[model samples]
Target: MDKKFAGKKLLVLGSNVGATDIVQYARDNGAYTIVADYYPADRSPAKRIADEQLLVSTADKDALEAFIRERHIDGILAGISEFNLLIAEELSARIGLPFYFTRKQWDMIEKKSDFRALCEKHGVPCPKTYVTGKEIPEDVMQQIRYPVMIKPVDASSSKGVFKCENEDDLRRYYPESLKESECGEIIVEQFVTGDEFTAHYTIANGKVTLASVDNRYPIAMQEGDPTTIPIARIYPCIYLDAYIEQVDAQMRALCAGIGLQNAILFVQGLYDEKTNTFNVFEAGLRSAGEAPYRFIKRVNGINAMHVLVDHALLGKTDFDSDKEDPYMKGKCCGIVSFVTKGGVVGSIEGLEEATAALPDVIEYECRYPVGSETPCGRTLRQLMIRFVMICDNREKMAEDIAYLNSHITILNDRGEDMVFKMKPERIWGIQ
Candidate 1:
């Protein structure tokens, strides 16, 4: 069938690789594209692909509204940022353009505490959670089981998320860590241990359409390190078909309870092997970064970027029914994010040779520039590059990952010094 977006103008908020793909897809499908970002120095791959580039703060409501009004933007799509998601929803409402989520729905998903409460009200199984801005009461502490997860109520990419082993860890991390979040409220919940996975979907006319399910194999053995981001995300998750069905039902109920309309949803949860239960951790009203998109596209042969753009431009209501199940032969495709250990990134070596060696490699992009000082911490800042790979054979997947790890290197301050090696098992345990 011919593309649906024939003459729409799309405004992409944020200029990352995901935004680049969206902008490029819009342009390729006969739509005008505008790439906007808050930081002027923030160079985006999309800027090179967009028809026009605008430096406007998404947080600045007036500037955003004026841009939409002056340019007659048909729709607004957010890159994988919570801050930008708010701007996208607001701009869509102000300009009378189709939006992924309404203002109320967006607010519900953005605030962690509120989202947990909503899930509880709807009878969805989420971790036992609470919020605190001060000292944890003795009674509250008694109620909360040990080894709980502590995190800021309104943060993403696992920023400030800590695993508190006991009361001491809680005291050490709270109040101080609370300041890091834009929202002061901190969330304390029971730490659910199991195989963690993410389900990505789109809601249209109150129906939940499953786009893809990603099994997140963390780069780090533990959470909260930037360098420890997902080393590999296998799409069409194996051994979770029944679990996915349960998750889909719960997600639909949660969206309906919050009055969510058209929008993209990224719901994260842990599947416990002991009890065979799926416990939700958190949810976002946006895409799951560029990594998941790569796998989704490879397996299904459907571009998630294009689907998002089409939703924004032509209204999600017009999506074709035949394209509903976008999985590819139940094969697994994965993405591994390359990260820095510490020190300035002097150079990236062996990428071309690595890809040439493994044709299963889909795409790889570096986020940092040469000579930029790499920040310390296990969190997202450590991420320097991203590599996507696709394979139907499970053994070949292992081979592909090993090939990339052996070839990639991150140089430190010393001219001849190479930083820590990227070990998939050390970062994210074998899945």
Candidate 2:
């Protein structure tokens, strides 16, 4: 394992599941790993595996730089959080390390409103939107169609998003949505109904490659739940070819226009199959926590994480990636999510044996172990586990999923079934 990063020190932000993977991956490649967050070392997963733990807050750049110089930190990587990504971008600039997007480029599309503007500027398709100030004008309100989505400009994870059925709903949810934003702004857009998907891209020296497209098919949660959460993320979206033909080039143009030379970006898209139209709504500039790198490695022999690490440490990376197939080269893949009605986790059983026994299961994570307390009204927080797999087809995937559901069991304090499993139709796309 002694490799290219042997003498380097890499500091990673946050201690969530994604940061844990970054820390271990860095250390495995011989880089000394440090995890920095305000959490106690015992409570932080990534810090537990790191060579050093920093209690300094990620926001305190001055304190972080002092330690960075003291430890001779050579590189920095942000976890899945967008706030941390901005911090990582700034730190890399100050430390003279390789970071993909400059602050100027990043700021142009950080907010939903601004991203929509970017799409319009580049001729990329996006939902119809209205950029408003503190108050929506009568003219704007009259022009807006019914059933619009109001979202905080700065929030993620579906927080502060509302689907307004009418003017009354907009007035009701706008202030609530505004409360969730750090910058005190919100954007309203038409709530387009269609199949939802996410496109993954890797960029190297201005060359953008469509790494993968997955069906982030939104599911119906409880009644009046404003959040549109994806049931699963299965590879090769139904409109993959149409997306490449219609939207991929414009997305690349948007990337190039922003001067992004080396980076990984994920775009949230909506497709109208009847009309063959595709549009983007949101995007993130870091490795998605779902860990697409698992199937990306299995399908294309490319490790996007490794490429990012190399760029961070060496100031340059050669992406020897096969970009020909964003469809996983005819392989079916997924990141299966298991959720539950909110409660305290009593015990989780047989996940280890199930994963080892299940065919084509590349990785699994029990995010919340036994005795963990989660909120009652939580959305994504209700996620109990995630499994990444690559199978031959939908039939094989169904078999693997059946095996997992039968083997793994999660219980609440009352000894009742707490886990919610997705049906085969939800796990794999119907089209």
Candidate 1 regions exceeding 4 Å error are 1-7, 38-42, 55-60, 130-142, 157-160, 165-174, 177-183, 221-228, 321-327, 368-372, 408-431
User: For model 1, where is the 10-residue window of minimal lDDT?
Assistant: 421-430
Give the 10-residue window scoring lowest on summed lDDT in candidate 2: 422-431
> Taking the tens digit of each residue's C-alpha lDDT, what string does model 1 give over 162-213?
8888888988988766876786778888888877788777666566667777
> Model 2: what TM-score?
0.90
Best by lDDT: 2
Best model number under TM-score = 2
lDDT of 2 at 255: 83
**C-alpha positional error of residue 87 in candidate 2 after TM-score superposition, expressed in Å:** 2.3
RMSD of 1: 3.8
What lDDT would each prediction earn against the true structure? Answer: 0.70, 0.79
Model 2 C-alpha lDDT per residue in residues 1-431, reported as the tens digit of each score:
45878999999988764687678778887999988989998889899889999898899998887888788889998677877878888888888877767787766666677778899998889889875456678889888889899988867657778889999999899899988888888899888877878787887756788888888745445776545555578887767888988888999888877877678888887788778788788887766667687788778888666666777787677777555368787788998878767778898889899998876998877778789875555467666788889998877887888888888899998898876776765554543
Model 2 C-alpha lDDT versus the unseen true structure = 0.79
